[model samples]
Target chain A: MSEKFSLSIEDLHVSYQLSGSAGKNKIARAVDGVSLQLHPGETLALVGESGSGKTSIANAVMRLLEPTSGKILLDGVDLVPLQGSELRAMRRNFQMIFQDPFESLDPRQRVIETVMEPLEIHGIGENQEQRRDLALAALAQAGLRPAADIGDRFTHQLSGGQRQRVAIASAIILKPSLIIADEPVSMLDVSLRAGILRVMADLRDQLGVSYLFITHDLSLAWMFADRIAVIYLGRIVEEASAVDLIENPMHPYTKALVSVIPVPEAIEGASRTILSGEIPSPSSIPSGCRFHPRCPLFRELGEPEKCLNEDPLLQISAKSESHLVACFFSDPSKGDTQ
Target chain B: MSLLEIRDLHVSYPNRKGEFFAVDGVDLTIEQGEFVGLAGESGCGKTTLALSIPQLLPEHSRIAAGSISFNGVDTTALNEEGLRAIRWKEISVIFQGALNALNPVQTIGSQIQEPIRIHDESVSKKEAQDRTLELLEAVGIPSHRASDFPHQFSGGMRQRVMIAMALSCMPKLVIADEPITALDVMTQAQILDLLRSLCDKYKLSMLLISHDLSVLAQTCDRVAVMYAGKVAEQGPTSRVFGSVGAQHPYTQRLLRAYPNIRHERKFIDGIPGYPPDLSTLQVGCRFADRCDVALSRCATEVPDLIDIGGNQSVACHLVSENQVGVQ
Candidate 1:
């Protein structure tokens, strides 16, 4: 166990049996043997397309959903083995801020009430007034100006950005060790997105809270996260520092994903590797490389026998020491596929 | 001749209080085979401008002043019948959300067929079906999936289906309003690539409206930067975004704020204040209140869009004078 590591998922495997009569008692693996570590006071972004099980992994970390197998270690304790009331106590250490702020907050509750809910639930505060004071302090920290005036207002009265602030304030009111933000700014307007990201960044510095930021936007991931893990078909295909991942992506899946991002000012249109087909369903994932069906490099390499049949384990690529990718090519710059 | 031309267009809406000009004194030209991007934050009247082009505004809204010409015909003067005749045949639209735009009850294939049937009454149902599937294939959707309902597809697939439906009648000009805003980064890239290829394949002129500067940068040939319903800057996409000369306060903040992988050590302070209440009529510049280094003159008089050598137009008092450069 690393003391500096705030969160760690070791060989996590989450599965659910097929629902209703259609289920022949077969398992649908949503997250299959995925693992990553988030250091204290750092942001680790999980970037992937929708239905890539990014949110599933987040839920497992927050203990909202129990992982079917493997260990979830938080602060040197294996959360997987904990059960009943003990697990509930451990759950308080990590909080989750959802994507839709409008739906997440209780409609009838005031801002102050919403923020103080966590404190009341934990029975940590001395009294109602003490909880109210703590809630107001959290509100002020999240940059809700004139905090006293806004605390009594309903969620509807506040703008999208303000609602998000309230949500953040509530998540941090308990002063949790790790915050799992699942696409927090996806619903916000373009300009407001930056503000929300900045608030999260500031909170990380102030409270020393680690973040597991899940989003589909790589550009944002590049900006906010110290390290990034690229998930494809419920598996982390590549994981590296933000700089290494962006500058020299090794995996064919990662390279394809990175090339699609539209650079704001670049005049020359960089050619993208157009994946030939749609992402395969989770039930029928490709055997060797989950991305091989849509991977242009794999097709060009013309080794379907091994490339599509033998599963490749996560290994160090030739790009950088910290960078790791799940690809047989080893060196992408050498044109192994070509 | 330009495919679409607007001269001094003014669109206004009346509420319980008073009349507010959402699109005021705006002029633009979309030449044949040109892809022009309309960029602005929410409530900046970018959508209002797009709607006004097709006379698709709500009952409260009216074309208070100006002329909109499409293919040498005045669109503002067209009656309901005349507008209906030209709506899909000349200029089509792909709206923000495809799921909302699509008919839930009807099969996507039939919905597409309905448009082509309406456009050419003499066409047989079999012909329409064949054409619909062909259009679907063109937009990169599986032709067989056209038989499926809108609810069956994902967000990205529905958008592609929307593109197919928009181009079914083969309109010369397409107005896509925030087409990819609802999609993920990868899907957004795929949709943009599809649009780019479709536009090139058919030589279609497009009016792309979006707040995402990066998407606009990739898909559009020319970009129009709008603030409060007026185009603050319009020019070649590369010049407007790449160079410091085309920097407006809003544009500069936009470039800096969005998290791009390429840039480093950049700290963007959020635009301090909110957008002005359009209902409260403004005599001076609408952005003057929020502009960081606003001069006294900015509060007194509105600055016109000054041409900066090239075709770029910027409506900032400070940037027009080259006072601040992009750091």
Candidate 2:
């Protein structure tokens, strides 16, 4: 059990029983033995490509899906044992903002109504007028100036950035201690992404809420996140602070991800390690190391038998700078960068 | 003559409010074997400009003014049949989300060979097959995998198949509209590298359209920024996006909004306004409402693109005034 943490996921394993194949006994482990912690007012980014089980972890923590095993603790309280009405009550302590705001928000509802519905469900205000005032305040905090006038418009009437802000206002109206944002700004254009991310960061400071920010972009994580965790095949291969991970990536997968980030300058002769293949299907994971099939480091070492046979657990790096890695060859000083 | 040239091009679509000129008096040029990037936010008309070059405009849209010339031939005057004759063998397009447009029931090999065989009646079956295999290899896909169906391949592989098909006819110019927008970063880098190498090998010109300026900066030789259906700025990628920096306010703000790992991390406000509506009345400047530095005359008088030395052109009143003062 963790002490005084906002959210702690211990040895989380989320698996699904595959249907119509392998005698109905085959199970696909979407999130296999993942552990993470978020302090109060902290932002931890789970970075990976598609099918890396970051979504599964988020869904499990939000209790949208039941995990196969392991405990999810919120403020030192285990969430796995709650049931029925108790589970519904526990949802008030946490909130979620999905990737696509258009799909998440209803077109028929007005912007103010959408933000007020959460307060009504949670019974936060004494009456309708009070709830409207609270909703307006949240909208103003979300950078929607003259919040009352903007709230009168329908969701369809607002721009993409404004719609995302409305969604954030709804998520933060309940004043949840923890928030889960799953690719929240990926749908918006590059120019509009900063506005949405800035609103989310500001909300954290004012409300003292912890954030579980999940994204596939390393640059966004490095720019916004306090800590970065590299997720590969449902496991954390590397974990470190944002500056530490981007400046000194030890894991081979993390190095490949950091190298592929496009800079806004015309950098000449800058070579990026293009991973050979896409992330393997979660259903048919590789034998030992999930990333060995497409890893450049594994092939560079002449296909070591240990990589093919022995699964490496997440361990501290050789330097032991609070940086964690699950790789046999992870010396940034040696310049594992290719 | 240049590979593709547009002179005062104007494109408009009918709306309830009025006629929306999506592309308004824009001019650009692409030489043979050059990689050009067209960037802007959504509804900024970069996609419209890219789609119009190959005469792939929607049925509702019309060419209101100006002309599009391909290799000294006026494409605007070409009939549908004449345009068909010029397509594929001369100008091909790789559209966005085209990976999902792959034929599900057909083998990728036959799909690549279809263009080669249809465009040339004299080519034999074996020649078409050989060309298909060669294109697959050029795009870094193994020849044997060509027999696989679209469902069997991943998203990146299916994109590679689309590229192979686009080059099957050996077109002189290929227009890729947001080619790698949906792929992961690693896959995007691989596809970008593949496109660069393939363009060099085939000696063809490319017009890559995307909303991400960082992507355009890295992949394009020259970058053009669009706003409110007009080209705000365009120049060599190094001068426009590099340390020398873009002269236009829209381009400068767009570059500032992007997240770059190479630079110090700081929170950005991201151009504090909505994208301009295309249906609004034609004015001096479409981006004037959102621009931070705007003159009083910007709302009344239109500013045309002026070439300010160093192969750069900007359509801003302040820039032109500064240029006059410098002279």
Candidate 3:
């Protein structure tokens, strides 16, 4: 696997048809001109608030939603161009782990039966017992208990953490190369979130799994992800290595986000850069830079003219090769900001 | 006197197989002008304790033991009318999920006025309207939006309305039971900041209950970690967060779950087992089955809440008896 990138999203654009008053036709661009690449065995966390187009990007990549425009290249092959049975077959290379584990798994089906469905659909495994054994193996890899205990249990019988492990078992049973986790641990308690992350990390190491981790938690993204991509309204504001982004974020939106995260040490009445505005509706995004409405620079400098007139593209500076940001007044390494 | 005190509180529900105790023997106290957070996983009797405070327990359930005192008065002994007198006027509650808690048919203004109307019928409609406007402004919501229904408001704004309703009667203590659970992280911060400022402005005591420790650590003065309907540990937020001698592995595992932004590329270490079922009677420590350092005595004898220095307390065997001597 000497590939340059495991999953490449190139100029991806996703739109939804909106109905106006009196049934008028309108189009809403949910994800616009977003491009990024995830390395093999590395995690690229797509972070944003609700309606920030993070989930839309995830859906577009998983082919759960049709991409109106743009290309999704997997292992040098374009997934967008493929259609019908060919696209369905191509989907086998990527698997999705949903946010709600209890809702994702079938309620009536037993654990073995649920995990076996994927194997059976993929037309792998020889017999029932073999599928059972494979399910047990996947469960064990996810740090589940003995094969006998989990085989006959229903989804409701298990706790949130255990059900998530079961979901992980189901996703990895097919042994896909890419895993799309959309807020996988958001519903669970804090004590169980780390355990799930560890399981995902172990799977990535052992089986070489690339991930598109979507979440609203910046702290988790800073810690777990190899690279962090900040999405706002429908565009990528910034993309950089996790450490670079956390320690020295260039984009104003990213900086505001990082500052608001309440860490234990940072709780001593630290004067944080608090952005004072609400998340705008996706249908009616602000002109120019999507974040211009809430950007402190727009307010403090009283120079909303340029920020409200020109759209910014993610551009690289003289810092790191991988680090990129989309802002009018950003300097990558130094605070020699424009 | 403490604004609120709970001594040996126990809540149980009747089932086909006798009775099931959701909240076992537990004790807690909230001082005046202090913000105490009650944190635990789901089914940890956090909500049960909250419901028990207002004498709002379900018909099938009752306070099997203990007493709840508010403003030096025994709340458990209060009758329906007696509880009503103190409900919003003395101690108010803000339930989780603003959409469900708010009446969709009523305007936000009327919803807020309901508390005032029920508490003091002598106040005229004009006074109620004036009070509603003031409450809305205090919560950062515009007075004009009071005419809007619950559905018209955003999740965060609706939560503000809920807070406005909770503060309508000028209660000394406000019990927010997972008020921001359904909101986004940014909205969550905004609401928390509002609550912090309001608590300061009014000098109001609060009982903030949630399952997320990180969420509570931001605004809480003190925190009590609950497990199996019992307080596993309680102390100042900083000391409890930074380092505490907790003998229970459950508490230790919870501290490890927070993601450290400074330490990138490191994986989180989550706890292994699930919480125990509340219905089952345990002879020893309730967390004994899942505890990593469980001793033989853990299976047969329950650990009492013992002091562990610096105003902290833990109910575990790992901390030396000298360090966590029984109170």
Runs off by more than 4 Å, candidate 1: A1-4, A20-26, A332-338, B243-245, B265-268, B322-327
What ranking emerges by DockQ with the best candidate at the front? 2, 1, 3
Candidate 2 lDDT tens digits, B69-99: 9999999999988898778989999988898
Model 1 per-residue lDDT tens digits across residues A124-220: 7899999999999999998897888889999888999999999999999989999999999888777787788888999999889999999998878
- Model 2 lDDT, residue A330, Cα: 70
> Which segments of model 3 are wrong by more than 4 Å?
A1-3, A20-26, A126-133, A332-338, B242-249, B262-265, B320-327
Tens digit of per-residue lDDT, candidate 3, span A1-338: 45688899989999887885832466677897999898889899999988889999888888888999998988778988788888877777898889998799888999888888888877788988898889999989988878569868998898888899999998899888899999999988777888888899889999999999999999988888889999988899999998889988888888888877866431576666766657887667778888888898677767757788989889885587778888877763555354
Q: What is the TM-score of chain B alone in each candidate?
A: 0.94, 0.97, 0.94
Worst 10 residues of 1 chain A by lDDT: A329-338
List, for all models, the DockQ compared with the true complex: 0.57, 0.76, 0.54
Give the CA lDDT, 0 to 100, for residue B292 in model 1: 79
Top-down TM-score ranking? 2, 1, 3
C-alpha TM-score for every candidate: 0.95, 0.95, 0.93
Binned by DockQ into CAPRI classes (incorrect, acceptable, medium, high), candidate 2 is medium
Location of the lowest summed lDDT over 10 successive residues in candidate 3 chain A: A329-338
Comparing 2 and 3 on lDDT, the stronger one? 2
